[model samples]
Target: MDARASAIAVRDESCVGDEFAPDIPGLKARRFWIRNSGCVIAAALLVTLSSTALLEPLSDVAPPTGPEQKKPVVLARTRRQSVTSPKKARLWMPRTGRPETLDLVERMGDGSMSQTSYFDISLDLNENASGSAASSASAVAQVADTGANPFDLVLQDALDARQLMRHSGLGYAADAPKAVRPADQSNVTVTPAQEAMLVRRIVSLPVQPERLRDIKGVIGVSEQDFAQLASGLGGDVVRKGEQLDLIIGQRPAQPNLSEILFARHLAADGRERLLARCDDGHFQLVTDHRPYDRMVAEALAHQAAEARSGSAQAVPKDVAALQDAAADYPKLIEHLARRNVPVKVSLQIVQLLRANGIHWSKTADVPQLDFVFRTAEQGEQELVSVTLKGKGRDRRFYRYVSDSGKPEFFDDAGRSVSKTLMHKPVSAGQLGDGFGWRVHPILRTRKFHNGVDYRAPMGSPIVAAGDGVVVKIDSETGYGKYIRIQHDGGYTTTYAHIEGTPKGLRVGDHVAQGQVIAYVGSTGLSTGPHLYYELRVGDTYKDPTKAEMPAGTTLRGRALEEFRQQIGRVETIASTIRATATSAAHSAVSALTPGSDKQ
Candidate 1:
């Protein structure tokens, strides 16, 4: 067509306000340029129009009402400004400090649509509905007299979190890759709203015996110790590759000490931070790098600010009473270990309590506190709750003064639970020899067999019989590869002729009842792949199947109520942290290889 004709066609179809040519569906504000004979072009004209204009048939259709009608509004493809000199992007959401670039907003769990707001999620993170403060003061005083050191207890508890693995439960996998949520992303959760929901769930969860115990222990720290505890526990959220935020599920929140009372997280550096949580919720630092006092001062200032704002507030903690409980915690555990109580279960219980906020702490110095309970077997002893032989009141020592004039407290210890035992260490095996005198297969003489033997394949997994520390893990001329675990009540169990334990595990490391400690094999003196097990009461060995050890005990009265309450907590957090089912036996792990640690 001629220039004149082409011009007329262009003007009629796409000229300004032309009805014949509809706007493009995708491009928001499109600019069109008209040219004559491909020589010179007129200035481009930018026009704003709807994206749905092109799809007239589909765009005209209305969406369903009610639930099905809920959907994020799709912002049409907007025509960007001039390519020669574009404008800078304006920041919107504070989390990323960048303009919204996503195609569409995600739907909430309730199927409701949400617009991009200043924060990642609009749910208020500072919402706290806890009353632990009102009761904590009295409880703290009661526990402080019990000699619990809250600071030391928390520090040691981290070391002991791994010990809780003794109980067979699913939890955070030790070998699982570190979860470092990116700054723009939420922790293990998908969004902040979801995280808030999880926090709510955790809050609604009744304080279990273990967690209450832990929380109590934590609250007992001296103010001085509390500061130290904060520093020690306080560090950049990410250690190595493991993001503390992901581990603790702490996302950065605006640091408003006046609004957020408790210290949740304080920034460690410009980008990273240290996270903490209370029964209520979490706190965060705005900028990284602040002293411990600075954060606490915020709470103090917040308290004052609240007072000025004329709002009711709970008093902040000034000291740590459970400070002494730290020393007493392990001591109490040791005492139970020396007794007929299941040491593994007891230690785990202590660890669980240590890990939680228990209100009570018993120390050796607590004037006349002696725990008395019934034994699990024939040798067991059960008595009425009465004054002991030399009961005397000692107000100077502790507050719980017994009616018989002694500041003594009595309660049932150890519950009637399954005795820690490995029915079969080998995944697939059979009893080859009984625990008694037998004709020595290799020695060719009648000798007393110290342990029962399980004949199995060369490389089957072997677990601990009960919870205990591996006192010895070495090989000898007779026992090829052996691991000896010292249990409660002066009892020690040995597994001989095993492949080996994993690296990182040493003699002092703790193991759980069902934790896989070794792989079955013949290391020392053995005919084939067989596990030689030995149960020793002090010096003399006993039959594994016949000997009646204090397996577990049942709690009654208040203690039972405490246990029933505490188990939920122990299970709640512990359930999420799981170890590899195979232990050091994983194919690629650095476990002791076959014949590697032979004595």
Candidate 2:
């Protein structure tokens, strides 16, 4: 088709629906009316009401008195009263005014005075007002002399002044009107009890600066007095830049006797006593004395038995002394233990006393004995040290951290007490299979087993045999889900047939000994739920039950030398404590044993 013919055809098709389209202008006009018709009607009604209001006031005016005199229209009026009715009137006056006579006058309808009666009025001033009686009386007298109403004078003064000024002050003349002072400006005398109550109320108030500022404005106290009040309430007033800050310190409550006793029982030095103040205003040592009392009773019974047995013969002085020492030995040992001496050290001390033939009465003659066990923190590390004064010298032990980052306790000879690996890692389980040739439970064939099995209920916890880093964590064909850990001394351990490992456990993560890493399961080629554990030394399997494990790390060189120095420091502290205890013991023994000579 030709270009012009094609354009004409397209235009005809586009105009097919034009005749059926709604009128846009008509729709728009309807919408505009719907949205704003109410506003237009309201505006017209307001204008009409305003015009009626403006014309109504003109009705009250009388019409012009020309040939026709028109009456004035009254919009509203009250009902008339009877002429014989009597009305009572009240007149108000200032409370500060003295007694004075007032004339009550009545006027008739024609505006002429008819009757006049005299009445006396007297008023008293408000007690809460800052204006003194003298100032109030003077103000009233001045108003009377000026022939002005005292009520108006007092009302004007109250409205014009912000604060009530003191009339007796030298700054103002006696006759001149003084500045008014507010009622709150009067000096307030607070007792100690009231001050304490106010302190409590102030502490509970909000600590915001705006809140505190409002309180200060209302209280009208000087900054110095406020500071003194805060100090008495166990608070500090600090000036921060231009702002003042109050810091209230709450005193820590003293622990009760029961709480104190619980703490002492759990403390390292259980023998420590507390000097507590009693309600009767005296101090007494608080300690568990039941154990000491039992020991003393046992000693007394033994002494009496020995004396009765020797009644039949004349006992020699040496024999009697030996019996006395024997009777006191048990009591003395208990006393040493109560003083925080170690059992081993106490035994050595008793042997020393026996060899020297020293009676309990002569305990002060024995060599000064010292023993200490303490945990101390140095920098970021915590160390436990023990010192024993025995066998004529002091022996020490220390828990030191090794190069492998494991802590081990070492004695004076540098020997460690902890073992390298645990024989059994799990708490509750039975040994199922040992490392050797064993018949496979599922396959029904003999196979060389590389590990041992611990039969346990499903989901039983499996712990690490030693402190090590996890080297492997993945599923295997026959082992199923398993984890292998690499320990020191060329040793490695494996835990197989685990249902699942703990969350967040991954390869290269360090695990401590006895830490639960996984749970037991019957995965892979197994019969039931069990833990397959293996121990290897450089790829060679070892029977955990038969093979001798490595001992804990030993201290050498500088480590050993430092341990000896720690022992000396502990001994020094122990010696000071022992000397004090010995003096107290000497006094106690003298009191218990009548006629015993003091050493």
- Winning model by TM-score: 2
Q: What would the TM-scores of all predictions be?
A: 0.27, 0.31
Cα lDDT, all candidates: 0.39, 0.45
lDDT of 1 by residue, 4-42 (tens): 985675656544553445566422133244323223322
- The best candidate in terms of lDDT: 2
lDDT digits (tens) for residues 451-522 of candidate 2: 888889999898888767889998887898899988754688888888999999999897777789999988
Which parts of model 1 have CA positions greater than 4 angstroms off? 1-411, 414-418, 551-599
Question: Which pairs clash in model 2?
Answer: 163-180, 163-181, 164-180, 164-181, 164-182, 165-179, 165-180, 165-181
